[model samples]
Target chain A: MADFFQSLLGNVTNVTWQMAVMWAIGALLIYLAIKKDMEPSLLLPMGFGAILVNLPVGSEALAPIKTLFDAGIENELFPLLLFIGIGAMCDFGPLLNDPKLMLFGAAAQFGIFFTLSMASVFGFSLRDAASIAVIGAADGPTSIVVAQQLRSGYLGAIMVAAYSYMALVPIVQPPVIRLLTTKKERLIRMPYEQKNVSKTTRILFPIIVTMVVGIIAPGAVALIGFLMFGNLLRECGVLDSLSETAQKVLANLITLFLGLTIAWRMQAAAFLSPQTLLILLLGLIAFVFDTAGGVIFAKAINLFAKKKINPMIGACGISAFPMSSRVVHKMGLKEDPQNFLLMHTVGVNVSGQIASVIAGGLILSFFAGLV
Target chain B: MKKKIFAVLAALLILLTPLCALADNPDAVETCPPMVQSQLEAAEGSITENAEIPEAPEAAEPVSEEEGASETSPAKGDQALSFGESLGYMLKGMAGIFLVTAIIILAVVLLEKIGGKKKDGQA
Candidate 1:
């Protein structure tokens, strides 16, 4: 009875205030996921895993989670594999119809570089700064790959910031978009023009993109290759079942494991630092800059173009996918219900996905050697 | 137009492949000079010894190449660049992305033309 009491009660005594704080943070994430419906697929698992790892249990008890981390995230397997599913789900026809929209994707990545400089100024090591700056990609997988490849110490904070900001795209982008654009610009309408894209073109796109990006930024080959490969599987016309499996089953399974495995690093000692707070702040800055960069680029293009483009479409250039696109579309609707910007914003949104991966690649190329 | 674009792409690929290979070649990696390397090793040894001897008087040695290198070394991953260097990276990165995007756009245009022809033939 004494031994039983010690075994049960002793561990309770070992729990520290930091662990208690982490529990609250975990509970808050769970509440946000359940009640607010913000990235529940990832946030829910991450919240539960946070509590699991932070328990006052011995390291031996948490060994399985660590093993999952080592096998999946540490080896860069999960994110790359997840990219295939993401690629399969994407329909690049919108982007293909208007390839100029791709430039907006490139422009939106300005936030990433801007945040890189800012994080360096704030005294983060170059690897950590680069990893942190990638949150501006508004891309979770890109963030994971960059953070893991760079071996940054703040992987947990970076992952949390990346995914949380991605989910908060609706909240983060509108204010920045409004600040950057006028009501006139916001109301400017872009009529969607659908082009009949050929099957051959659709099939060729992923292959060409992989080759081009691979040649330019070899460091990102794994990311772009897996992504484009999945796209190829989707567009090939014969692999419908495989594509469906990748889009649904494979993606969900990996996301589940990736979410839970990420919590291995969310222990109080690693995550409850001043730097984590700074990382969150920096992530917000990156998102804001990305929005501003795209809007400003559109405004700049309007100076030369014959037709005025709705600058709000530019805000969709962040890689938060349908969320960023939807935010811009809803904002357009609010400005003028007749102004339907969904198609235009979706084009820019998909292009942002490609551009974000390239941005991740460029960061890897530039810093892989320096670091 | 198709032939010219293909020729250009082929030429670009041929020109760029060797550069990529060179970049990835680990043998091309530069190392610190032997003298600097020896000094760094010695400095690291002294620092480790100092860490072990908590009671020892703190040394007032000037910051050496070892310390500077530590800030920028691959092993440390804590390289903090000056604002100017970071800006240089920004410019270079943006330029690289735009260049690649332009190339991709060119290729897409070429592919579109080819695909249009195929569709027309099928129709």
Candidate 2:
């Protein structure tokens, strides 16, 4: 059986320690992604990609994988294209109604900078730390944007870490929320009055924001513009079918491709290095700090607010989008069934997504100047 | 209580200046090397500073709000990479995130649409 396997590929007798370890790690990620249903779309593909790289196929025929790596990832194409689908999926209505939630978005990015400094202290170069700090975004687009701009060699590891942490957002955020806010604080229900936003406002919201964020950060134009474009399609009232396509068919198909492509980046030798482990650790730090900065900022706001804002929603300030928002809403419900922080949390959550993207673009622009 | 809520909201909005403050123009792409980046990162902090209170609500005033944000920021390399290559990387990095988010949003929208008690007739 071993001889036959070797004949089909390479010599099983020549299996290196690195390849063996990589195969194990790949298999484990597959188990986690599939069996545990933990980010299966990405992990399954990543696991598959990992397995292929470790298959020991000789000759230049299998060089296509390497080509895929050089062509798409090296140029940062995939991350930007996926933004369109993400924008289509994102509903910024909650945020538009409550524009102040943009503060939470800005605050949530505290972790990225804080972690960048920490990563630097821990021996990573500036660009590498910047890439690693994006894991705090808990939003893959932001991470990809930052990493691609940073030219970090471990884009795959950084991506995997970001997605895994995001899927674990529910688990990660609640503990942090609890640690920061007392039960009374969580129970502090703020009434959400749904504003009857004008159709004009909805239509103009994306355009206006694109103008605003674009002028401030031109690099963010691609991300914020596409995202707002998707939102514009949804609310334009003229392109219902287009909106539906962007949200459903177009979004889903792109997601499938995005998942497979990211998985392709996870070569064992490149991914399983000491740097990969460091990237994972730094990613976690970025998240923790992002949560801290957001919650702390919210608490600071509460000190000055007359209506007693819910600090829990502040934690949702991270760019994990609706997941962070949902976590806050769930926590609110746990504290008081009457409390509906969903809209408010969603407001902050969506804003965080926008803010993170802008933050990402800013980081890219910031780091781009270095070289 | 309602008044307090209003007051709370008003106060919270006041602090929101900082949020708008931190969000300078995002078009800046930081892809410079280590040495040049450290200098650029230092400049990034100032852009946040200059990103102070929104001066003009007019969407037309683009660069005026924060010249420092873009004035000194690094420029993107002029590369004419094909759109296909760009699309693939975006998907690879973001497909999982969008998938999960879409599933959740779909569920929420579905629940709100189909399961909300009878229109204007609920208990």
Candidate 3:
């Protein structure tokens, strides 16, 4: 009886105060995910994974999550798989209808480059700085893929920042948009016009985009190709079952595994660094700058255009997708009850999604040779 | 024609601003010696190509094992960078993204023109 108790509780005796702290942090994340409903899909699993990995187990016991990390994250499978699901779920109809909004999407990626430089100024290496800057993409998967490609030391912090800031887009974007644009600019209304896009156009759009991005920025081919393939699955109509599977079942499963796998990097020593704090701070700055970039770009364009654009539409260009679009829509409504920017914002928002993938590939391309 | 020219010019200006910034900074990429730069590039390529399994926590005696492992991981190192170099990379990267964006915009504009012409022909 004594020997059995000793064997069972021996691992418990090895638990450090830091492990206890990590458990608390994990519990907090779980609480935020469940009670606060903050990015529940990822936060819940990540919280559980953090606790599971940090628990005191005997030296001989196998760490299962580590295996998941190796299989999923280390080889860059999960993010790419998740992109397929994302592409399947995305409807590019709004963007297709209004092709010009793609400019805003491109403009918003200013945050990633700006943040990269800023992170470097803060004393990060080129690789780590670039990875951290990708948090500004307002994209979780892109951040993960870029950071993994760069082999950044702060992967856990970067992932945490990317997802957290995405969830916080509603809160982060509004003040920045308000600060940049006047009440009149925010209230500027562009009439909603629906232009029918041909089925052939829809089919060709993804293929053309994949080819264009692949040729120009070959490094981004994998990221863009997977995404376009998923979109192809959706638009082709014959692959309805496969599209649905990719959208629902595949996305959910991969997200769960991806969340849990990422926790392998969240061990107390890995996560509790001063650099983690800096990363979180820099991530917030990136979000702010991305919003500013879009808003400012819109304001700049408005100067030359005969038709005034609701400058707030620019704020939706970050890769937060429907969330940023929805936030801009709500802001438009608040500025003027009759203002409808939903489709317009969504258009730019989707563009941001594509632009972000392209930006990620571009970063890898430029930095691949430099690093 | 003028509007199209203006739009294209604006896009080019947006794309070129970063490259101009890179050119302004003389010491940015050139400061790093060629051999070290190549090695860094190689290391980066290999790291991305090979997915080495990260160290996991020991089931038992977790604290001591982790403490030792944590000391050796790259995350703990302090990487210092001067502001100029950071700005250089930032400009270069931003230029690359903007250039791609400019090309995409031109493609979309062409598509729109083609689509409009098709509609006119149909009418």
Interface Cα RMSD per model, in Å?
A: 4.5, 13.8, 5.5
> What is the lDDT of every predicted structure here?
0.83, 0.66, 0.79
Give each model a TM-score: 0.87, 0.74, 0.84
**Residue A196 deviation, candidate 3, in Å?**
1.4
Error of 3 at B31 (Å): 20
lDDT of 3 by residue, A70-189 (tens): 888988899999999999999999988877788899889888888887887788886888889899988888888888887788999898888888988988999999899898898898
lDDT of 2 by residue, A20-80 (tens): 7777867877898878887777777776777777766573745776676566566666666
TM-score-superior candidate, 1 or 3: 1
- The collision pairs in model 1 are none
Native A-B contacts reproduced, model 3? 0.46
Query: What is candidate 2's lDDT per residue for B1-123, written digit by digit as tens?
Result: 434534544554443322332333322223336674465446444443323212222432455446645433332222211233222222212221222222223333333333333432553
How are the candidates ranked when ordered by DockQ, highest leading? 1, 3, 2
* All candidates: DockQ: 0.31, 0.03, 0.23
Question: How close is candidate 3 at the interface, in terms of C-alpha RMSD after superposing the true interface residues?
Answer: 5.5
Q: lDDT by residue for model 1 over A173-279, one digit each (tens)?
A: 99988898899998898888888888888999999999989988887899999999999999999999999999999999999999999999999999999999999
Clashing pairs in 3: A57-B59, A57-B60, A58-B59, A58-B60, A59-B60, A371-B40, A371-B41
Candidate 3 chain B worst ten-residue window by lDDT? B48-57
lDDT of 3 at B3: 86
lDDT of 2 at B8: 47
Best by DockQ: 1
